[model samples]
Target: MIRTKIISTWTILLVCGAQAGILESPNYYHDYAPTFHHYHPQPRPQPHYIHCTPEVHNVIEVIPPPVIVRVVEKRRQTAKDLLDLICRALTDMGGIASEDNPEIGARIIAKLNIEKDTATLIYAEWKDGVNYRSRRFKRQAAGEDRVKNELGDLLTKAGDVIESDKEKLSPAAQDKIDSRHERAVDDCQADVCKSHAAKRNRIKEAKAARKG
Candidate 1:
């Protein structure tokens, strides 16, 4: 009986030891179930509310310089050049520059009237040469009103061409042309008279010789 009782005690102690070994085991208890934790799902981050305006990446306003258009240059002309142009305009009007000048004085000289914006035009030939008048001496003065009027027309035409107006010529301009025409005609007549006097003197000398 005592042996059976001892065997029963030993069997109970062995069962208890086996249970304790299973609970304290590193591989089964510690490694498998270290800590029992409850995991609750976290809410996602809400995006920050921003203003409607788009963000400017660059500090300076990124705009290219405005396209600059170049202006066209206008033609430049001087007053004297304008007068020469007017002379050309005159030639186109079927008027000879100087009637007395078969070819002597074709060129002109110009004076400016700044107050009236007018040009005084005269042929170069009129100003030269001297005049000697005696009772028998007669020199035709250069005063061709017809040529003056034609020059006036030319001046008017040129004015219209430049300013698109017929009132372009001032009174001063007309006076200048008139005076020039008169001078040119007088010079031509004087030269003619001188030639005639030379011929008359030669004839008189021949007549006296014949009488002697």
Candidate 2:
């Protein structure tokens, strides 16, 4: 019986020592346990800058307008001057005499009254036994009136031709023609009484010779 009791006591102590060792092993489990935690990096932002621009302007130039001119002209000679020139040309051509035929002079003067630079009428007068009678002759009249009328017609025609061909003649040439025409008329009418004086002298000499 004692042996049995001692063996029971030794088994009880062994069981108690195992229970204490188990209870002290809790500190080792706490020191070796894993912890729950998370770590993250934060991002930084960049700075912004502002840009500037410049403005421009344009310029233009203006111009002025042009000018215009006009011109006017006047006649060189009058119509009366042209008429006198025609009459003078006729007398120079021996178509009419300054004396003896007062009828021709009267007709010319009357015709000149109508117009200066135009053709005029010239009538023929015949001695009807004692009195002078006036008559209109056709284009074939053979008297001084016909000659004068033809010359006047010629001057009128020449004036027309000159007007048509005005560009061909220079101003100097026109002046020369005018001067020549005037000189011819003046020469025809110059020294009228000189011939009468000479005739009277010849008559006086003849009378003296007869008396001697």
Candidate 3:
């Protein structure tokens, strides 16, 4: 009975010792318990682009339209223009007038007044260096119609020459020659006449050749 009691006491002490060892061990539940760990998210990397390269494209050229130019014709001058030019020329040269003559004749003289716009034409008959009869006519120096027409009429009435028909020798008198001096009186005069005859002959030959 003592042996049985000692065995019971030994068994109780073994159980207590086993319980104390389990409480004192540091890794008793190391594998069986849930584990916690601190985790940080990492950022994703971005792709790199080429920014230094230049882009290329096709270029088109545009042309503008051409500009046009117009030209005008110049006007032609007439006989009236010539007359006006003459009048202005005479006016610039102060004025012009005819001189008296000893021979019996009619004369016409033109005078431009100080105003330069009016012109006067004088018609006169002269005998023995004296003016026998006189007439005065006036007209404008320049214009489109009246001046030109009036000047033309005055010019016609003035006539081209101042000599009279009476002073002119008759055909019978001109034809009549002195028999005493029929030929040239000097050798120099005869040579001059020969030269003039030769010149006339050369001109006639040239004209005949051209006509042929």
Task: Choose the strongest candidate by TM-score.
Answer: 2
The models' CA-based lDDT, in order, is 0.40, 0.42, 0.35
lDDT tens digits, residue span 148-175, model 1: 3333433533322323221233444444
Q: Point out where model 2 deviates above 4 Å.
A: 1-142, 182-212
By TM-score, how accurate is candidate 1? 0.18
Question: Which lDDT tens digits does candidate 2 get at residues 122-154?
Answer: 221211221323254432333433344443344
TM-score of each: 0.18, 0.20, 0.18
Best by lDDT: 2
Clashing pairs in 2: none
Model 1 clash tally, residue pairs: 4
User: Candidate 3, clashing residue pairs?
Assistant: none
- Evaluated at residue 123, the lDDT of candidate 3 is 11
Q: What is the lDDT of residue 199 in candidate 3?
A: 65
Worst 10 residues of 2 by lDDT: 123-132
